[model samples]
Target: MKKLLFFYFLLIGFYTYGQVGIGTAMPDPSAQLDVTVAAGDKGVLLPRVALINTTDQTTITNGNVESLLVYNTATQNNVTPGYYYWYNGSWRRLTALGDHPETITTLVNNTDGSYTYTSEDGTMTTFTVGGMMVDNGDGTYTFTNPDGTNVTIQGVSQALTILSYDNNTGMISYIDENSTLTQLDMSLAIDSWETLTDLKLNPDNIHLDYTDEDGVTNQIDLTTLVQNLETLTTIVANADGTFTYTDENGNATQIDISNLETLTSLALNADGKTLEYTDESGTVTTVDLSSVITNFETITTLVDNGDGTYTYTNESGNTTVIDVNNTETLTELVLSTDNSTLTYTDENGNDTIINLKTVVQANQKTTTLADGVNTTVSSTVSGDNTAWQVNVATAKGANNTQNSTLGVVKEADSNPTVNIANDGSLSVNLENTNDIKEVSGNYTVLPNDTILLGNASTADVSIVMPNPVGKKGKTITIKKQDTNEDYYINVYGNINGLSQLYTALPYSGWQLTSDGTQWKITNKF
Candidate 1:
């Protein structure tokens, strides 16, 4: 029965400690252990803060324990290799060691009491081995390697390999010297860029290169050309933001005014005329010009009035006044004049009449006139000692005899005195024969002749008269002083002087022609 009891206890112990035993949330105090804990006052090996070596199941003092905290002991059996072991009585962190953290069933503790983890995909091998324990003070401890590499605990294993860094300087150094830098990366910088689109310009301000609607070519620089838009056809903006167009010349015009506010002025030299302008509001507003001047000849008029005034008479005898000083004011000025009576005001204001034709009459004197009596007379006519015999006779009675009828008698004087009656009848008295008996017998007296009857010695004579002469216009007149004396008078229409006449019978029996063509002797009757 004891053996049976012993087997029962064995079964009970198996139930308590074997793999089939009930697992405890806490390790048992009396369980067979791989490491022992020292009693109280084991200075640095206080069970709660010490690590025991599970491999030899030995109590490790200060020299054997790596730290005050429990460390994972992986080499010993029955010691849950990672994280913690049954020691004085608490759990501790450890390092994990496995091919992959995902497949890891165990982990190891580091000398610094930190935990390490691994990855499943060879992505991470060991998080930290013998990592430094950092008190983050936030219930988390960071692990680091002796070279100060960062540690990661993941998936119950270490799946990361960390590069070490200097905590003080942040410097990184390679554990291996076999690697080299190959290439680098870079970028680019820019200043500015812009794009201009279609723009139209003023025709008067800017010159365009284009085929205008009228098919003209206008080309100009931004500085010196006026666009005659009258000829532009179409305008286009080029890729360079310049303008181009077609003009009447069928040529292309280009304009490159980038950002100008106004185009520059240009001078034109064409013909004798010029085209100029000033710009305003993008248009040419003030346009002015000077012409190519010319000259011409002028005409002038002369006025008889030297005071620069003119008098004009029309066919109707009307007069007009005009000023000659002003050329622009001169219209048609008709002038006229008449005869020697033409008169005008002289410069001295004198009324001066110019006489070119005037008539003058000469003075004349007559000698004898017997009232109610007729007589024959003769006298000596003299001018400057040139003497001639003059016989004066008158019209006779019906008997062809002197009215006195002294009969036929003789006359002695070559010149006789004569009295003329109003009836122009005359009688003669002989110089010596005065008796009626001596004057008896029928007697006859002739004109222009002195007749002596009975004898040539008698002083009585009969004067003869010729036919009456016609009166002629004379340049000068001569008058006889004594009316009682009968004088032979000579008359001439025109005379150079008294020396130019013939001496024939003086003027007693002479007849003068009207035009002075000839002189002839006529018989006294």
Candidate 2:
């Protein structure tokens, strides 16, 4: 009975835990079945299978088993001998000790028909020929599999590696994958390059074909254009702040100035007598003004105050007033009655006398006086003068004495008479003494003629008066002595606002006077 009860308790414990243990009495609580070896040198050996590919699950008899672990022994279809487990409908390889699972991130096709693989950690590995592959050197490579089967594969040309670039020749020097050096013209491969529209041009390196004055075509750089410009000899400042440059041939061109330093300030230092100028460049230049301001005070203006005073102003803006009343001014100069001294009087009524005898000596002379017939004489004597007078005595002419006389006589008179009065006056009598000028035809009036007598019996007479420009208040009379025809008196200037005057009757006359601008008829008869 006791043995049976112990066996029943054991069976209930097994049912309650539902665990299986091998070679041990206690099983782990986390696992359904636990296998353990107590003291043996044995290990669990998993089942081994040949997997054609990771995705082919039909190779395993229990292909649907998701977590089935196995050791793959196949080397075909990229499957190697490794431990793998069934996961998500594929056989996934397990990493060995000290190994990391790397995924291929990139693949590059090489020019030599090989492929380069880049792993996720940036490790690059090249896939050249396979392990069993050999190059035949005749555009083909042979691959030998483990089954002893040989296969020939076509080989591509070796890829080229760029070693250097020659910009001047537009060529590239490179070495091929076979270690052979070669050069390629970049100009021939220009179509493979991208067009650059914003390339910076270097003036010194760029060349151009230029035709010179001698008709020679020469290769020059862009900088040559600036070097060939006309050289300037002189620069002049213009009023508009521009500069005019004159070349050697006297041709001038104006250039606008920019970014030039400007004068910031100009000041004068009175103590140092210097003019300091500062520019925008923070440079200061000093000019000595000692020569220009040599004098401390320079009188600029002087005003005479009419009241015997004057006001003067200096360069320093100071004014000074001066009185000239006390200054002596000459008023009069007199000579003494004896002619021995001269006296000068000033404005202040002061006199200064000078002795004339010391300067010059007086000269005196005397002569005897005599009287002629019928004359009485008197003589007086002075210091520097001798006076002598002779008085004639009145005498009556002889009662019967007659004096011969000369006189002028007219052509119609036999003789002319002249009389001498007792008062020493003479008188002569002539037939016709009137100043008369007779004109027969055209005659211009003379400046000194007082009367013009015209006889129009043969032809009409025309008398022209003198110009009245300078002859102001002068008079001339024109008379028609005969009445056979009318006589005309003409004046070059206006005569009483008329140019001429006419007289028809005998003894008719007109007297004209010059009123400066024109002649006026003052009298008509």
TM-score of every prediction relative to native: 0.10, 0.19
Model 2 root-mean-square deviation: 54.4
Q: Which residues of candidate 2, in runs, are more than 4 Å off?
A: 1-13, 97-525
Candidate 1, TM-score vs. the true structure?
0.10
Ten-residue region with minimum lDDT total, candidate 1: 184-193
143-244, model 1: which lDDT tens digit per residue? 554343555433333222433433233232333233422111100000011112223454766554554545565565665422311122334456765655
lDDT tens digits, residues 1-525, model 2? Answer: 999999999999878579887776787888788888987877887888898998876887655488889999899996888999989988889976557763335545465745454445565555442344677879877755434568675546643354565535544466756777756443333323222222234456776655543556566566767544323244445666565544343445555534222224444444534556554445565644433222111124456565755565544455656443443333444545554565755445678796644322223122456776667699787995667887766544444557422222212234334445576566764323324698888888765577888888767777778778888988887888886644443334478788777766788888888889988889889
Tell me, what's the RMSD of every candidate?
A: 71.7, 54.4
- Position 76, candidate 1: lDDT: 45
